[model samples]
Target: MSQVTDQLAQFVVFILDQERFALPVEQARGIERWRTPTRIPGTAAAIMGIINQRGVLLTAVDMRVILGMKPITPTRRSRFLLVHEQIDCAIAVDQVLDMLQLDLSLAEPTPHRGTVASRGLLPTPFGFATWLDLAALLGSINNG
Candidate 1:
Protein backbone atom coordinates (compact mmCIF):
# COMPACT_ATOMS: atom_id res chain seq x y z
CA MET A 1 0.00 0.00 0.00
CA SER A 2 1.13 3.53 -0.70
CA GLN A 3 0.83 6.54 1.53
CA VAL A 4 -0.12 9.97 0.32
CA THR A 5 3.35 11.22 1.10
CA ASP A 6 5.25 8.55 -0.83
CA GLN A 7 6.83 9.91 -3.98
CA LEU A 8 5.95 7.65 -6.87
CA ALA A 9 8.29 6.62 -9.68
CA GLN A 10 6.39 5.88 -12.83
CA PHE A 11 7.60 3.48 -15.53
CA VAL A 12 6.17 2.26 -18.77
CA VAL A 13 6.48 -1.52 -18.81
CA PHE A 14 6.58 -3.16 -22.20
CA ILE A 15 7.35 -6.52 -23.78
CA LEU A 16 9.58 -7.48 -26.67
CA ASP A 17 9.14 -11.14 -27.51
CA GLN A 18 9.02 -12.89 -24.12
CA GLU A 19 11.30 -10.51 -22.24
CA ARG A 20 10.03 -7.55 -20.30
CA PHE A 21 11.61 -4.13 -20.31
CA ALA A 22 10.84 -0.68 -18.96
CA LEU A 23 11.60 2.96 -19.47
CA PRO A 24 10.78 5.87 -17.19
CA VAL A 25 7.43 7.45 -17.95
CA GLU A 26 9.10 10.81 -18.19
CA GLN A 27 11.13 9.53 -21.10
CA ALA A 28 8.07 8.84 -23.21
CA ARG A 29 5.46 11.28 -24.44
CA GLY A 30 2.79 8.57 -24.80
CA ILE A 31 2.08 5.10 -26.20
CA GLU A 32 0.42 4.59 -29.54
CA ARG A 33 -0.98 1.54 -31.31
CA TRP A 34 1.70 0.21 -33.63
CA ARG A 35 1.70 1.73 -37.07
CA THR A 36 3.72 0.70 -40.10
CA PRO A 37 6.31 3.31 -40.95
CA THR A 38 7.72 4.32 -44.30
CA ARG A 39 11.19 2.85 -44.60
CA ILE A 40 14.09 5.22 -45.09
CA PRO A 41 17.49 4.63 -46.69
CA GLY A 42 20.95 5.09 -45.16
CA THR A 43 19.65 4.81 -41.59
CA ALA A 44 20.55 2.59 -38.65
CA ALA A 45 19.59 -1.06 -39.00
CA ALA A 46 17.27 -0.77 -36.02
CA ILE A 47 15.49 2.27 -37.35
CA MET A 48 12.35 1.13 -39.16
CA GLY A 49 11.91 4.65 -40.48
CA ILE A 50 9.42 7.55 -40.17
CA ILE A 51 5.80 7.52 -39.16
CA ASN A 52 3.20 10.28 -39.23
CA GLN A 53 1.12 10.60 -36.11
CA ARG A 54 -1.45 13.34 -35.75
CA GLY A 55 0.42 15.30 -38.42
CA VAL A 56 3.74 14.94 -36.56
CA LEU A 57 6.53 12.84 -38.03
CA LEU A 58 8.31 10.39 -35.77
CA THR A 59 11.32 8.20 -36.43
CA ALA A 60 10.11 4.66 -35.76
CA VAL A 61 12.70 2.43 -34.13
CA ASP A 62 12.39 -1.34 -33.83
CA MET A 63 13.32 -2.16 -30.26
CA ARG A 64 13.78 -5.85 -31.06
CA VAL A 65 16.60 -5.20 -33.49
CA ILE A 66 18.14 -2.67 -31.15
CA LEU A 67 18.05 -5.24 -28.34
CA GLY A 68 19.50 -7.92 -30.64
CA MET A 69 16.32 -9.89 -31.17
CA LYS A 70 14.85 -11.04 -34.43
CA PRO A 71 12.46 -8.56 -36.02
CA ILE A 72 8.96 -9.67 -36.81
CA THR A 73 6.13 -8.15 -38.75
CA PRO A 74 3.97 -5.89 -36.62
CA THR A 75 0.83 -7.41 -35.21
CA ARG A 76 -2.39 -6.07 -33.71
CA ARG A 77 -0.94 -6.25 -30.20
CA SER A 78 2.12 -4.17 -31.06
CA ARG A 79 2.63 -0.72 -29.51
CA PHE A 80 4.77 2.35 -29.91
CA LEU A 81 6.31 4.32 -27.08
CA LEU A 82 6.68 7.92 -28.20
CA VAL A 83 9.89 9.63 -27.15
CA HIS A 84 12.26 12.51 -27.96
CA GLU A 85 9.62 14.94 -29.09
CA GLN A 86 12.14 17.40 -30.53
CA ILE A 87 13.61 14.69 -32.73
CA ASP A 88 10.23 12.93 -33.05
CA CYS A 89 10.97 9.29 -32.23
CA ALA A 90 8.72 6.30 -31.59
CA ILE A 91 9.88 3.01 -30.14
CA ALA A 92 8.14 -0.09 -31.46
CA VAL A 93 7.28 -2.71 -28.92
CA ASP A 94 5.53 -6.07 -28.95
CA GLN A 95 3.06 -5.08 -26.24
CA VAL A 96 2.63 -2.70 -23.32
CA LEU A 97 1.98 -4.55 -20.08
CA ASP A 98 1.46 -1.84 -17.47
CA MET A 99 2.28 1.55 -16.07
CA LEU A 100 4.17 0.78 -12.87
CA GLN A 101 4.25 3.11 -9.89
CA LEU A 102 6.73 2.37 -7.14
CA ASP A 103 7.61 4.42 -4.09
CA LEU A 104 10.70 6.38 -5.04
CA SER A 105 12.05 6.38 -1.47
CA LEU A 106 11.87 2.59 -1.32
CA ALA A 107 13.62 2.07 -4.65
CA GLU A 108 16.71 -0.14 -4.62
CA PRO A 109 19.94 0.49 -6.45
CA THR A 110 19.84 -1.65 -9.57
CA PRO A 111 22.85 -3.91 -10.07
CA HIS A 112 25.23 -3.32 -12.95
CA ARG A 113 24.16 -6.18 -15.16
CA GLY A 114 26.21 -4.33 -17.79
CA THR A 115 24.64 -3.53 -21.11
CA VAL A 116 24.87 -0.03 -22.51
CA ALA A 117 21.19 -0.30 -23.44
CA SER A 118 20.12 -0.93 -19.84
CA ARG A 119 20.28 0.98 -16.58
CA GLY A 120 19.67 -2.25 -14.61
CA LEU A 121 16.92 -4.30 -13.05
CA LEU A 122 13.62 -2.82 -11.93
CA PRO A 123 11.78 -4.78 -9.29
CA THR A 124 8.14 -5.35 -10.12
CA PRO A 125 5.37 -7.26 -8.40
CA PHE A 126 5.61 -9.92 -11.08
CA GLY A 127 9.41 -9.98 -11.37
CA PHE A 128 12.27 -7.80 -12.60
CA ALA A 129 12.10 -5.75 -15.75
CA THR A 130 15.19 -4.64 -17.66
CA TRP A 131 15.38 -0.92 -17.01
CA LEU A 132 16.36 0.83 -20.18
CA ASP A 133 18.75 3.74 -20.59
CA LEU A 134 16.78 5.47 -23.30
CA ALA A 135 19.52 7.88 -24.27
CA ALA A 136 22.01 5.08 -24.74
CA LEU A 137 19.52 3.01 -26.65
CA LEU A 138 18.46 5.87 -28.89
CA GLY A 139 21.61 7.94 -29.16
CA SER A 140 22.77 5.98 -32.18
CA ILE A 141 19.85 7.39 -34.12
CA ASN A 142 21.41 10.81 -34.26
CA ASN A 143 24.97 9.55 -34.20
CA GLY A 144 24.35 7.02 -36.95
Candidate 2:
Protein backbone atom coordinates (compact mmCIF):
# COMPACT_ATOMS: atom_id res chain seq x y z
CA MET A 1 0.00 0.00 0.00
CA SER A 2 1.03 3.61 -0.44
CA GLN A 3 2.44 5.22 2.68
CA VAL A 4 -0.42 6.17 4.96
CA THR A 5 -0.10 9.49 6.74
CA ASP A 6 -2.29 11.66 8.90
CA GLN A 7 -2.37 14.33 6.21
CA LEU A 8 -3.68 14.03 2.69
CA ALA A 9 -1.57 13.60 -0.41
CA GLN A 10 -2.35 15.37 -3.67
CA PHE A 11 -2.53 13.40 -6.87
CA VAL A 12 -3.07 14.20 -10.54
CA VAL A 13 -6.14 12.17 -11.38
CA PHE A 14 -6.52 11.17 -15.01
CA ILE A 15 -8.71 8.82 -17.00
CA LEU A 16 -7.60 6.08 -19.40
CA ASP A 17 -9.97 3.71 -21.07
CA GLN A 18 -12.82 4.97 -18.90
CA GLU A 19 -10.92 4.03 -15.71
CA ARG A 20 -9.44 6.43 -13.19
CA PHE A 21 -5.77 6.58 -12.21
CA ALA A 22 -3.61 8.78 -10.02
CA LEU A 23 -0.03 9.97 -10.03
CA PRO A 24 1.52 11.58 -6.98
CA VAL A 25 1.79 15.33 -7.48
CA GLU A 26 5.49 15.28 -6.69
CA GLN A 27 6.13 12.96 -9.61
CA ALA A 28 3.95 14.91 -12.00
CA ARG A 29 5.91 17.73 -13.65
CA GLY A 30 3.13 19.30 -15.66
CA ILE A 31 0.39 18.58 -18.16
CA GLU A 32 0.66 19.77 -21.73
CA ARG A 33 -1.61 19.83 -24.74
CA TRP A 34 -1.01 16.73 -26.80
CA ARG A 35 1.71 17.48 -29.33
CA THR A 36 2.34 15.04 -32.13
CA PRO A 37 5.54 13.20 -31.22
CA THR A 38 8.14 12.29 -33.82
CA ARG A 39 8.20 8.57 -34.28
CA ILE A 40 11.34 6.46 -34.10
CA PRO A 41 11.95 3.21 -35.88
CA GLY A 42 12.35 -0.14 -34.06
CA THR A 43 11.06 1.20 -30.73
CA ALA A 44 8.92 -0.76 -28.34
CA ALA A 45 5.18 -0.86 -28.84
CA ALA A 46 4.42 1.23 -25.79
CA ILE A 47 6.95 3.88 -26.77
CA MET A 48 5.09 6.32 -28.97
CA GLY A 49 8.46 7.99 -29.64
CA ILE A 50 10.33 11.11 -28.61
CA ILE A 51 8.73 14.49 -28.21
CA ASN A 52 10.33 17.85 -27.68
CA GLN A 53 8.47 19.63 -24.95
CA ARG A 54 9.73 23.20 -25.05
CA GLY A 55 13.10 21.99 -26.42
CA VAL A 56 13.62 19.22 -23.84
CA LEU A 57 13.32 15.83 -25.48
CA LEU A 58 11.21 13.22 -23.73
CA THR A 59 10.02 9.72 -24.45
CA ALA A 60 6.30 9.59 -25.06
CA VAL A 61 4.96 6.48 -23.40
CA ASP A 62 1.46 5.40 -24.25
CA MET A 63 -0.33 4.74 -20.97
CA ARG A 64 -2.87 2.53 -22.69
CA VAL A 65 -0.09 0.32 -24.03
CA ILE A 66 1.70 0.34 -20.70
CA LEU A 67 -1.47 -0.61 -18.83
CA GLY A 68 -2.63 -3.12 -21.44
CA MET A 69 -5.70 -1.12 -22.37
CA LYS A 70 -7.15 -0.39 -25.76
CA PRO A 71 -5.35 2.24 -27.78
CA ILE A 72 -7.00 5.59 -28.40
CA THR A 73 -6.71 8.12 -31.14
CA PRO A 74 -5.28 11.50 -30.23
CA THR A 75 -7.98 14.10 -30.01
CA ARG A 76 -8.34 17.68 -28.77
CA ARG A 77 -8.98 16.24 -25.31
CA SER A 78 -5.67 14.31 -25.21
CA ARG A 79 -2.82 15.59 -23.06
CA PHE A 80 0.71 14.70 -22.05
CA LEU A 81 1.18 14.08 -18.35
CA LEU A 82 4.82 14.95 -17.78
CA VAL A 83 6.70 12.92 -15.19
CA HIS A 84 9.70 14.25 -13.27
CA GLU A 85 12.37 11.67 -12.56
CA GLN A 86 16.00 10.78 -13.21
CA ILE A 87 15.09 11.04 -16.88
CA ASP A 88 11.92 12.99 -17.58
CA CYS A 89 9.20 11.43 -19.69
CA ALA A 90 5.58 11.99 -20.62
CA ILE A 91 2.55 9.72 -20.56
CA ALA A 92 -0.29 10.09 -23.05
CA VAL A 93 -3.63 10.02 -21.28
CA ASP A 94 -7.17 10.13 -22.59
CA GLN A 95 -8.23 12.89 -20.23
CA VAL A 96 -7.13 14.68 -17.11
CA LEU A 97 -10.06 14.77 -14.74
CA ASP A 98 -8.67 16.79 -11.80
CA MET A 99 -6.23 17.05 -8.96
CA LEU A 100 -7.31 15.35 -5.76
CA GLN A 101 -6.17 15.21 -2.17
CA LEU A 102 -6.92 11.81 -0.74
CA ASP A 103 -6.08 9.90 2.40
CA LEU A 104 -3.79 7.04 1.52
CA SER A 105 -4.80 5.38 4.72
CA LEU A 106 -7.98 4.56 2.88
CA ALA A 107 -5.98 2.90 0.12
CA GLU A 108 -6.18 -0.84 -0.25
CA PRO A 109 -3.14 -2.99 -0.73
CA THR A 110 -3.18 -4.90 -3.98
CA PRO A 111 -1.49 -8.18 -4.71
CA HIS A 112 1.99 -8.08 -6.20
CA ARG A 113 0.34 -9.69 -9.18
CA GLY A 114 -1.28 -6.35 -9.89
CA THR A 115 -0.21 -4.18 -12.80
CA VAL A 116 3.35 -2.86 -12.86
CA ALA A 117 2.27 0.75 -12.34
CA SER A 118 0.13 0.20 -9.25
CA ARG A 119 1.47 1.50 -5.97
CA GLY A 120 -1.94 0.91 -4.42
CA LEU A 121 -5.64 1.43 -5.01
CA LEU A 122 -7.33 4.56 -3.66
CA PRO A 123 -11.05 5.11 -3.39
CA THR A 124 -12.17 8.55 -4.56
CA PRO A 125 -15.72 9.94 -4.68
CA PHE A 126 -15.52 9.44 -8.44
CA GLY A 127 -14.18 5.90 -8.27
CA PHE A 128 -11.14 3.83 -7.33
CA ALA A 129 -7.85 5.19 -8.68
CA THR A 130 -4.84 2.99 -9.14
CA TRP A 131 -2.08 5.10 -7.68
CA LEU A 132 1.04 4.96 -9.83
CA ASP A 133 4.57 4.04 -8.87
CA LEU A 134 6.07 6.09 -11.65
CA ALA A 135 9.74 5.52 -10.93
CA ALA A 136 9.13 1.81 -10.97
CA LEU A 137 7.01 2.10 -14.06
CA LEU A 138 9.47 4.21 -16.03
CA GLY A 139 12.41 2.16 -14.92
CA SER A 140 10.67 -1.06 -15.86
CA ILE A 141 10.00 0.25 -19.34
CA ASN A 142 13.57 1.43 -19.71
CA ASN A 143 15.05 -1.77 -18.33
CA GLY A 144 12.69 -4.11 -20.08
Candidate 3:
Protein backbone atom coordinates (compact mmCIF):
# COMPACT_ATOMS: atom_id res chain seq x y z
CA MET A 1 0.00 0.00 0.00
CA SER A 2 1.10 3.59 -0.57
CA GLN A 3 2.79 5.30 2.37
CA VAL A 4 0.27 8.13 2.23
CA THR A 5 -2.58 5.67 2.43
CA ASP A 6 -0.97 3.86 5.33
CA GLN A 7 -0.38 6.94 7.48
CA LEU A 8 -3.32 8.84 8.96
CA ALA A 9 -3.64 11.44 11.65
CA GLN A 10 -6.52 13.30 13.24
CA PHE A 11 -6.85 17.03 13.63
CA VAL A 12 -9.11 19.35 15.54
CA VAL A 13 -10.24 22.11 13.21
CA PHE A 14 -11.34 25.52 14.38
CA ILE A 15 -12.19 28.91 12.88
CA LEU A 16 -10.63 32.32 13.35
CA ASP A 17 -12.34 35.07 11.46
CA GLN A 18 -13.27 33.29 8.22
CA GLU A 19 -10.10 31.22 8.05
CA ARG A 20 -9.73 27.70 9.33
CA PHE A 21 -6.86 26.33 11.39
CA ALA A 22 -6.06 22.99 12.92
CA LEU A 23 -3.87 21.24 15.48
CA PRO A 24 -3.05 17.62 15.84
CA VAL A 25 -5.76 15.96 17.91
CA GLU A 26 -3.24 14.33 20.20
CA GLN A 27 -1.95 17.71 21.28
CA ALA A 28 -5.35 18.92 22.45
CA ARG A 29 -6.60 17.92 25.86
CA GLY A 30 -10.18 19.08 25.36
CA ILE A 31 -12.46 21.77 23.91
CA GLU A 32 -14.71 23.96 25.99
CA ARG A 33 -16.95 26.98 25.63
CA TRP A 34 -15.56 30.45 26.23
CA ARG A 35 -14.99 31.42 29.83
CA THR A 36 -13.68 34.64 31.31
CA PRO A 37 -10.03 34.12 32.17
CA THR A 38 -8.46 36.12 34.95
CA ARG A 39 -6.16 38.73 33.49
CA ILE A 40 -2.49 38.36 34.24
CA PRO A 41 -0.62 41.64 34.47
CA GLY A 42 2.63 40.78 32.68
CA THR A 43 1.68 38.14 30.18
CA ALA A 44 2.38 38.38 26.46
CA ALA A 45 0.06 40.37 24.22
CA ALA A 46 -1.22 37.18 22.70
CA ILE A 47 -1.94 35.71 26.11
CA MET A 48 -5.55 36.49 26.90
CA GLY A 49 -5.07 35.51 30.53
CA ILE A 50 -5.52 32.36 32.55
CA ILE A 51 -8.46 30.09 33.20
CA ASN A 52 -8.86 27.31 35.68
CA GLN A 53 -10.02 24.06 34.16
CA ARG A 54 -11.06 21.48 36.70
CA GLY A 55 -8.15 21.87 39.11
CA VAL A 56 -5.51 22.92 36.64
CA LEU A 57 -4.70 26.43 35.51
CA LEU A 58 -4.42 27.07 31.78
CA THR A 59 -3.04 30.18 30.14
CA ALA A 60 -5.41 31.43 27.46
CA VAL A 61 -4.02 32.85 24.26
CA ASP A 62 -6.03 34.77 21.74
CA MET A 63 -5.42 33.39 18.27
CA ARG A 64 -6.74 36.49 16.50
CA VAL A 65 -4.21 38.71 18.22
CA ILE A 66 -1.39 36.26 17.50
CA LEU A 67 -2.41 36.21 13.83
CA GLY A 68 -2.55 40.02 13.63
CA MET A 69 -6.29 40.10 13.10
CA LYS A 70 -8.78 42.33 14.80
CA PRO A 71 -10.56 40.82 17.72
CA ILE A 72 -14.24 40.04 17.52
CA THR A 73 -16.78 39.83 20.31
CA PRO A 74 -17.23 36.31 21.53
CA THR A 75 -20.35 34.56 20.35
CA ARG A 76 -22.16 31.44 21.47
CA ARG A 77 -19.99 29.47 19.09
CA SER A 78 -16.75 30.69 20.59
CA ARG A 79 -14.56 27.98 22.10
CA PHE A 80 -11.23 27.31 23.77
CA LEU A 81 -9.01 24.47 22.76
CA LEU A 82 -6.82 23.20 25.59
CA VAL A 83 -3.52 22.25 24.01
CA HIS A 84 -0.45 20.67 25.55
CA GLU A 85 3.02 21.03 24.09
CA GLN A 86 5.97 22.35 26.08
CA ILE A 87 3.23 23.77 28.26
CA ASP A 88 -0.46 23.30 28.88
CA CYS A 89 -2.52 26.18 27.55
CA ALA A 90 -5.68 27.17 25.73
CA ILE A 91 -6.32 29.22 22.63
CA ALA A 92 -9.47 31.11 21.83
CA VAL A 93 -11.09 30.56 18.48
CA ASP A 94 -14.24 31.85 16.85
CA GLN A 95 -15.68 28.39 16.61
CA VAL A 96 -14.77 24.76 16.79
CA LEU A 97 -15.32 23.37 13.31
CA ASP A 98 -14.80 19.62 13.28
CA MET A 99 -12.45 16.72 13.72
CA LEU A 100 -10.80 15.57 10.53
CA GLN A 101 -8.85 12.42 9.66
CA LEU A 102 -6.32 13.03 6.95
CA ASP A 103 -3.27 11.54 5.34
CA LEU A 104 -0.09 12.69 7.09
CA SER A 105 1.63 13.27 3.73
CA LEU A 106 -0.92 15.90 2.75
CA ALA A 107 0.70 18.50 5.00
CA GLU A 108 2.79 21.00 3.02
CA PRO A 109 5.46 23.11 4.67
CA THR A 110 4.24 26.62 5.32
CA PRO A 111 6.07 29.22 3.26
CA HIS A 112 8.74 31.22 5.07
CA ARG A 113 6.52 34.30 4.95
CA GLY A 114 3.56 32.46 6.42
CA THR A 115 2.34 32.83 9.98
CA VAL A 116 5.02 32.06 12.57
CA ALA A 117 2.79 29.68 14.46
CA SER A 118 1.98 27.61 11.41
CA ARG A 119 4.17 24.60 10.77
CA GLY A 120 2.35 23.65 7.60
CA LEU A 121 -0.83 24.09 5.63
CA LEU A 122 -3.41 21.50 4.78
CA PRO A 123 -5.86 21.78 1.93
CA THR A 124 -9.30 20.48 2.62
CA PRO A 125 -12.41 20.20 0.46
CA PHE A 126 -13.84 23.23 2.21
CA GLY A 127 -10.67 25.31 2.06
CA PHE A 128 -7.14 25.45 3.47
CA ALA A 129 -6.32 25.18 7.17
CA THR A 130 -3.08 26.26 8.77
CA TRP A 131 -1.54 23.55 10.90
CA LEU A 132 -0.54 25.12 14.20
CA ASP A 133 2.91 24.41 15.58
CA LEU A 134 2.15 24.40 19.31
CA ALA A 135 5.78 24.39 20.41
CA ALA A 136 6.62 27.37 18.24
CA LEU A 137 3.49 29.13 19.39
CA LEU A 138 4.36 28.57 23.05
CA GLY A 139 7.91 29.68 22.42
CA SER A 140 6.67 32.87 20.83
CA ILE A 141 4.50 33.47 23.85
CA ASN A 142 7.38 32.92 26.24
CA ASN A 143 9.78 35.11 24.31
CA GLY A 144 7.34 37.95 23.83
C-alpha local distance difference test of each model = 0.76, 0.83, 0.79
Give the least accurate 10-residue stretch of model 1, judged by summed lDDT: 107-116
Candidate 3 residue-wise lDDT, 59-105, digit = tens: 88887876777774689999999888977889898998888876667
The numbered model that scores best in lDDT is: 2
Give lDDT tens digits, candidate 1, residues 1-144. Answer: 222344667888888888888877777788998778999998788889889989988889987876667885788989888976346589999888898885555545565433344766777775778878787767655554
List the RMSD of every prediction in angstroms: 3.6, 3.2, 3.4
Best-to-worst ranking by TM-score: 2, 3, 1
Encode model 2's per-residue lDDT on 1-144: one tens digit a residue: 233357578888999888888998888889999988899989777789889988989999987876667776798889999988787899999999998889888899865423474878998878998887777777666555
lDDT of 1 at 142: 54
Off by over 4 Å in 1: 1-7, 103-115, 142-144
Instruction: Report the error of model 3 at residue 54, Å.
Output: 0.8
- Compared with the true structure, the alpha-carbon lDDT of candidate 1 equals 0.76
Worst 10 residues of 2 by lDDT: 110-119
State which candidate, 1 or 2, has the greater TM-score. 2
lDDT, candidate 3, equals: 0.79
